[model samples]
Target: MSLFEELLKWDKDQCRVVGKKFELGSWNKLSEKDRLGMIGELIDLLCQRLKIKDKPKVILTTLDNAFGAFSPSENTIYIDRKTLSKGGILTACYCST
Candidate 1:
């Protein structure tokens, strides 16, 4: 299989493993610290699933017309804080992927 196909399959498998632990909409009720931790975990999971070697740092910030943004200079991801309700952290995870 092609690399993209492998990664897509990997992501689906990982999501199955993760889904067992988290119910739909469960990402919303976590505390800020827990949410950040979860985001970090998602990043790690994405790295493994997508085979990314250089993982970018994640930061939450206000944004306009964007769910997430990336800074190549600093190798960081800026997640829109406003979008983080109702399983919104999944948006951040998608951005990481």
Candidate 2:
């Protein structure tokens, strides 16, 4: 099965194996630089399950929530989606290695 399928299945059956909501909060509370770095690391872990690229298919609730993705290939950062005006929660789907 694909990594995405496996990860989704695990989340459905076991719920939390590697990273969960509570654990994510601790990780998210880090500094802006740290958060971005951690997110990058998390993306690596997630890649084991999916082929993640620099451009991600972002799914956002509002255009105000902060969002960014590191483009390793181009060696640059890109904003897949932005929530510049509205206010709401942001849910980013990340691939884990």
- Top-TM-score structure, candidate number: 1
| Weakest 10 consecutive residues of candidate 1 by summed lDDT | 88-97
Q: State how far residue 75 of model 2 sits from its true place (Å).
A: 8.0
Residue 5 displacement in candidate 2 (angstroms):
3.3
Could you give candidate 1's per-residue lDDT for residues 34-97 as a string of tens digits?
Answer: 7667777777887876779999898888889998788999989887877654455553333123
- Model 1 Cα displacement at 2 (Å)? 3.3
Model 1 superposed RMSD (Cα): 4.2
lDDT of 2 at 7: 62
Scored by lDDT, model 1 comes in at: 0.68
| Candidate 1 displacement at residue 33 in angstroms | 1.8
Instruction: Identify the runs in model 1 with alpha carbons over 4 angstroms from their true place.
Output: 11-13, 19-23, 91-97
Candidate 2 residue 42 C-alpha distance from true site, Å: 1.7
Q: Show model 2 residue runs off by greater than 4 Å.
A: 1-4, 11-18, 21-28, 51-66, 69-90, 93-97
Residues 1-97 of candidate 2 have per-residue lDDT tens digits of 8754566654432224334422545544555444455445555655544555543332223323345444555555554223211211124443244
